[model samples]
Target chain A: MEERKVILDIHNFSIAFEQYENGFKKTSLPTIRELDVTIHEGEMVAVVGSSGSGKSLLAHGILGIQPYNATLGGEIIYDGEILTEERKAALRGNEIVLVPQSVAFLDPLMKIGPQIRKGKKDKASKEKLDGIFKGFHLKEEVQDLYPFEMSGGMNRRVLVSTAMMGNPRLVIADEPTPGLHMDMVRRVMAHFREMADNGAGVLLITHDLEQALEVADRVVVFYAGTTVEDADVKDFEKEENLRHPYSKALWRALPQNGFQFIDGTQPYVKDLPEGCPFGPRCKECTAECKKRIAYREVRGGRVRCIHAV
Target chain B: MRHHLLFIGKNLIRMILLLFGVSVAAFILVSVSPIDPLQANVGQAALGSMSVEQIEKLQDYWGVGQPPLQRFLAWASDFFRGDMGISLLYRQPVLEVIKVKLANSLWLMCIAWVISGVVGFVLGIISGLKKDTWIDKLIKGYSLLIASTPAFWLALVLLMVFAVWLKVLPIGLSVPIGMEASGVTIGDKIQHAILPALTLSITGISNITLHTREKMIDIMESDYVLFARARGESTWSIVKNHGLRNVILPALTLQFGSISEIFGGSVLVEQIFSYPGLGQAAVTAGTGSDVPLLLGITVISAAIVFGGNLIANVLYGIVDPRIRRGGKRS
Candidate 1:
């Protein structure tokens, strides 16, 4: 909230992509709609959303590597400076890094050693390479092994080591534990926590609510390309103060045996019901939800649905 | 070493069968020619002018009196024994005549292949990574135009523009062979090999280029590339470390069929340039109906195609681990 306090601030960020039709943009939705968020220095933010909710798309824009079709609006500020094209050039890989979903960060043909070497840092910085690999529970011999040799978890951890090797300020990890076993997920979450504790801002993007709750300090919920809620992880359990019905329903659907599952569906994008995108999915839905559109900040969080008191 | 040898041997057997099939097709087609080589040679050299004993002798010598299967078997048996008989035009052993020409052809083809394949693959990768970009669209259009069009015509156009119009190079017989054409130096031969080789390579290069680009696009857009990019890898590094490896494997498969690829399309390029290669020899023998010569060229070309496929199979194990020993064990 204060000047020079936030490390990364995305204000009114939206993305529309051009398609084959020439005159119109395509995809199920615009991806991100009026999404405002911030990351303080040395803070960890977790992005949790349904598939196609544009969490990845938002990351692409923030990283300034959105697919060629992406047309982004609004300003992204990093450490009190607005991120221009030139600023993004400096920010990439050096200031911020992303550990994508498992095994995606590797080159299939190349050995693991060179992959880490391909980072943005200088030669002397490369001496720390072996040390970093050791830290990730990998053998020093793995440096020469091709991606095909290592297990899936090994590949994901290798990318994480490469990410932190440069001493980057921010790390965005998308789907860190999608298909991993419970033990492996805990291991990766521990790695994220370790990085966050070491004073690097880590944004964990995933669909797993439990995984986010395990390691994330703060959580941002996305529904239908819009930010539905932003709240502290400590307060994620409070049901009444939760603003968006979509957000509340998501919390309900967590597979707790005693937890009551909310009966609501995520709104379909193209043929969406009018007004609040979550209206059709909300158990407390009414006709008035169609007419009102605004993000209301209540006690525990900020939510997009106007029905919240 | 044993593993490699065994793999090669299996592929070689498949190659032999393919070659045998192609040879049969060539033999049948040559046999069906409307103009008889004997007739074309001597206006129905019936040996009718000879006495009864002599006519029988001539028919026997030519193997015409034998049944078709017996004749074919005899021909095959003789071929295995390295006796290709004599060429009507050259008056030399067909094998001897072809050896020199095949060498020249192989040399030219090797050079052309090296240039075209490397260039095409590189361009394909670049074009593929940046698909729909100006460079990608340009390379795609250029490759499509080059590949769909004929190589011979393109050679002639290049020859006209680069040699005749510009006076940059010579017209024909640019290199001396067997001390025949003023004994030109190796440099001169290379200079001469340049134009003809270019003609032979353009379409192959273009075809390969286009195919590689298409493959690269698939590889680049894969979930893998996104993962690599997200790791803060530079665009160039991404292209090299990840994109190139994945994209180029399928293109490697393309080169496995390089045998049929070169000979099938190179016939016209050979004819246009008057390059004394297997293709040209085949054309001459086919036109003249010189059965033995035709058979030799047909078998050789078929063998080349066969070898190419064989090479492709072995290459599979090298490029993709899924096809290799470790993969099989799993």
Candidate 2:
């Protein structure tokens, strides 16, 4: 395979929030630690994890829109340049776009047309938005209505249209297909795939691995706030081809793989083990597993487990 | 547009019915009181020397000799025709008495209302943006202090300081006594208005400030605001365009309730400064058992309050698209 140009490169990323525990006794709660993910030009990368895996935080961190108390560590590079706060502010909504998870993210008071156009009243912008809306099956009159005047599915379509309206080079879609029917989910995933085919780097964050594998070029599995494995879609064809123990477990849990179940839950951030976050639940636990493990490339795939063959 | 018009029409009818109910309640309450308008108008010495025929003649002149229901009906009919009846104390037409004083009170309260609203909104935004910081703490402390302190006492203290001690403002009244009513300049009205307006504004400013602060903080944390930030919108633009609309819609509803506070606060503040507004006239009517004057002021006040609320609802429809569009389908 030809080496594609890197559009977004995130390395050793960490996110911690400063919170008041009890009456001004402050503590730092580290949610994401030592995370790494990279998106290449013309590629759709899916970051798949269950709830509490901090997948959404990675999107917010990339956008520089993290909450005020959240302290971010490590570097994020966009097109070979350091993505500083200033650069993020400048490029956001133009070069990079986020399809947010909640329908509530749409301003209830604002009309759909102006919001998608970002208040641009010019003829060309309006025409372009109308085209996008038509593509999404939204009526011309829907632009005059408020978010509260629309259904949840309609609002989600509007959100997708918002990202489509902008000529963004990178699209971060955070659980964009939830509550959607199977056909609608496939349709939305096809939109992301189309964007990647047009050379935009797309990061599709979802917990549904089955759906992700249908569209994504690469799958980065997150477990307990850290990346456990980065494998191509072909690697997910069989459990043996996957590198991480957790990834193998996840693959076996799929209905096609006999629906094998893991016993323990992913530990909370406060109770996370020192080395491998999945150590407590891994069958290959040893004394060496208690020490910090670095993500290493094995068989052209990245894995965090040392004993991966 | 047609739906909005129908909604407004319905609200107007409701307001009229509310005024009728208020008139009936006010008439009953005033009629059941022990004081007699005839006795209140005539002195105690004159009452002792007067004959029964003279007393009956006095009651007839004052229009209190009729049954309460009969009197109320007559007054209501006359009110519909724009005749507010006659004041027993001032011995003048009630409408005439209220016209000038009502204008003066409206001007004073309007100024106070505008000043307090602007100041409160700015302070609220600041406190909300800097929540849990020293600036927010100071604003909270100030609002708490003002809320706890009585408006009347605050007026008196302000009166003593600004008028008597500082000698910077006029002591009492809406205008100087000898100036021609037409000749009285805006400067003169403002000079006399400063203390009373400040007195009326303190409690309202504090109330609105705290309410707006709480509302803005919640709105700033809302998902839409975070989304806007992620869209690369500047903080000021987001606050002004998005945050203020949501915050001020609820604040506007709270402001309509403050109309009653303006009237209620004006009574004491007007009496304290001898400012001749409707509140002072209402107080004088109460003390002297001037039944027609009291009832007239009550009707006018009820009309203003109802009108204020109607205006607020209309403004609410204009500000909130959800209400204007009659909510979402499914």
Candidate 3:
């Protein structure tokens, strides 16, 4: 296979929040300890994780839009250069776009059209928005209505249209299909696939493995704020093909896979065990797993477990 | 547009009912008071020399001998016919006395309101944008001091410094004594109004500044604002377009609600400065038990309050599309 040009590369990224405890004593709570993700041009990578696995924080960190208290570590390289804060600010909403998770991101007092267009009132921008809105099955008059006047599903579609408005080289969509119906979900996934086909790297952050598998070329499994596996979408076809123990457990828990659940819940950030984050939950855990484990390549896929063959 | 018209009509009916209620309440309170209008019209020395028959005739003339309910009905009927009756203290038509004073009071109130609104809102935006900084802390401290200070005391302090100590401005009254009323220039009026206007504006400024800063900070933290920032919109544009638009509604509501405080402050400020405004006349009427003048002032104050709220509601409909459409839908 030919080497695809890398569009986004995030290596060993970590996020910690500084909070004041007991009036004046400051403490740092690490949320994402070590996360690594890479996307190539013309590729759609789906990041699959359960809630509080730091999926959305990864997206915000890449965009340099994290909350003020968060302290980010490690490097994020975009294109061929290191992505600095200034570069992120300059490229945001132009070369890079984010489809936020909540519909409340829409301004309640502003009309739908102006918000999606980012206040562009030109004829070409208007017509382009109309075309995107039409593809999403939104009416022409819907653009004139405020967000409070629209349904949750309609607002989600409007948010999707905002991403399509700009010619973004990278699109980060965070749980974009939650309130949408099955058909709308499919349509949105297809739209992201189309963007990927057009040379844009699409990062679809979601909790639905079935939905991610339907459209993504690659799947990155996240467990307790760290990447446990990075494999081709076809690896999810069977438990034997997957590389990590946590990934296999996730596949088994799917409805179509006999709905088998693993024992114990994902560890909270405060009480996280040392070494491998998934050590407490892994059935194959050993004394070696109590030490820091590194991500290693196995059969062209990456896994963070010492026992993975 | 029809919906807007209906809304206005509904508010107008409410205003009329409110005025009627205020009139009845004021009349009953004044009638039940131990202070007798007959004694007010005639001095205690004069009352001591008068015979019982003479006193009864004077009471009958002033309608104080009649029952409270009868007097209220009679006043309401005359009030509806545009007659405010006679002022026992000033011995002039109550309407005539109020008309001149109302104009002066409105001028002072408007000047104070505009100055406070502009200054408070601008300071609020600055403090909100620079939150947790020393500048923000300084403004907060100043607002706290002003809020806690008494309006009358502040007025007295200003009068002593600017009028007596500095000797750069006049001490009291709207117009200088011995000058033709028509000869009073705008500059002269402003000069005389400085201390009173400042006194009236301090409390309003404190309240509005605090309210506006809180609302602005809240809006800056809203999800929509963060979304706007993600769109690479300039900070100034976002603050002007999204931040100001959302904060103004609450700020305007606060401003309208402060109209009562403004009037209350005006009464004290006007009394200290003897500015010849309605507040001073109100004080005189209350002290002398001038029933007709007091009732007239109460009705007018009620009308002003009701009108201010109505204007605020209509403006809210114009500024917020949600209310505009929701009003129609309901």
Candidate 4:
């Protein structure tokens, strides 16, 4: 296969929140630790993780939209350049767009048309919006309507349209299909797939592995706010192709893979074990796993487990 | 268009019912009060010197012999017909007294209202946007202090500072005491109004500033605002495009709601300032047993307050398209 350009490269990203605890003393909660994800030109990478595994925080971190109290660590490289805070601000909306998780992200008082257009009234923008609305099966009049007037499916489409409004180089869709039906979820996923096909790097942040496998080129599994595995979509077709024990567990838990689950829930961030967050739950966990495990390649896929061969 | 008209009609009917209720309550309260209108209006010496027949005539004129309900019905009917009766204290028509008094009060109240609304809203936005900072702390502290401070006490303080100590402005009244009504310049009226208007505005700011700050903080933290930032919207752009509309609607509700508070404050404020506004007339009528004048002022003030709320409701539709459509479009 030809080497496509790397559109976004994330390295050791961490997010910690400073909060007031016990009188006036402050403590930092490491919500996301040493996470990593990479996307290439015309590729969709799904970062799959359960809720509070900091999947949403990863999206916010890349966009520099993390809350004021949050402290971010690690570097995010976009288009061969370091994406600093200033660069993120400059590239956002025009080059880097975020398809937010909920309809609540839309301004309620604003009309749908102006909102989707990002308040653009130019003729070209208008024509482009019309085309987008039509492609989404939304009536032209839908633009004149408020978000509260639209169906959940239509609003989701409208949100996708916002990312399309700009020719984004990177589209980070943070759990974009929640509260949507299976059909709607597929439809929304298809929209992200189309964006990737159009040559924009699309980061599909979701928990549903089955849905992620439908459109994503690679799956980056997040465990307790850190990436444990990054493997090709084809690698997920068979459990033996997966390197990490967690990936095998995830594959086994799929409905088609016998509907099995491992013991112990994902640990809370405060109580997370020293090295591998998945150590306590992994059947193959050894004393070596107790030490810091490096994310390295094994059999053409990246794995954070020392025992993975 | 039809929906808007129906809304207006509904609010108009509501306002009328509210005014009627207010009028009846004021009439009943005044009737039950321990103050004997005969004693209050006529001096003890005059009452003792008056013949038995004269005392009965005075009682008849005051409508003291009639049932409270009967008097209210008579007053309500005459009120609807535009005959507000005569003011026993002013010795003039009740409408005429209210008209002049309302005009003066409107000027003072309107000035105070605008100042409070504009300044308070801006301060609130600044405080909320800069939450936890010294500026936010300062505004919060100021609003808290103002909120707890009595309107009458504030009015007295202002009166002493501007009128007593400085003596640059008039201490009391809407116009100069020696000046004829026709001769009183707009400048003179404004000069005299400064102290009272300041007192009312200062007192009014705390409520709007505090409420709007709460609302602005909520907007700043809202998911939409966060998303807007993610979309690369500048902080100012986010405020203009998202925060303003959300905050302004609730702020407007508080602004209009403060009309009653302003009017209530005006009563004590006018008393301290000795301003010849509706509040001062209200007190005069209340003390002097001028039933017709009191009822008229009560009804008019109630209508003004109701009218303010009606305007606010109508404005909500203009401000928010969802309300304009009567509900959510879907």
Best by lDDT: 4
Query: Tens-digit lDDT track for model 3 on A196-300?
Result: 999999999999999999999999999898899999999999899999999999999899999999889999898899889999888898999989889889877
Task: Please write out the lDDT profile of model 4 over residues B210-322, one tens digit for every residue.
Answer: 99999999999999988888888899888888888789899988898899999999999999888889999999888877889999999999988988888888787678777
- B117-182, model 2: which lDDT tens digit per residue? 778777887898789999999998998899898888999999889888998988898888888989
lDDT of 1: 0.75
What candidate 3 gets wrong by more than 4 Å, as runs, is A122-142, A149-157, B1-9, B32-46, B49-66, B326-330
Poorest 10 consecutive residues by lDDT, candidate 4 chain B: B321-330
The fnat of each candidate, in order, is 0.51, 0.63, 0.51, 0.78
Per-model TM values vs. the true structure: 0.89, 0.89, 0.93, 0.94
Against the unseen true structure, what C-alpha lDDT does each candidate score? 0.75, 0.87, 0.87, 0.89
Candidate 2 colliding pairs: none
lDDT of 3 at B242: 83
TM-score of chain B alone in model 4: 0.95
Task: Summing lDDT over every window of 10 consecutive residues in candidate 2 chain B, give the lowest-scoring window.
Answer: B321-330
* Superposed Cα deviation of residue A216, candidate 4 (Å): 0.8
DockQ score, prediction 3? 0.63
Residue A159 shift from truth in candidate 2, angstroms = 2.1
For each candidate, what is chain B's TM-score? 0.87, 0.90, 0.92, 0.95
RMSD to truth, every model: 3.5, 3.3, 2.6, 2.3
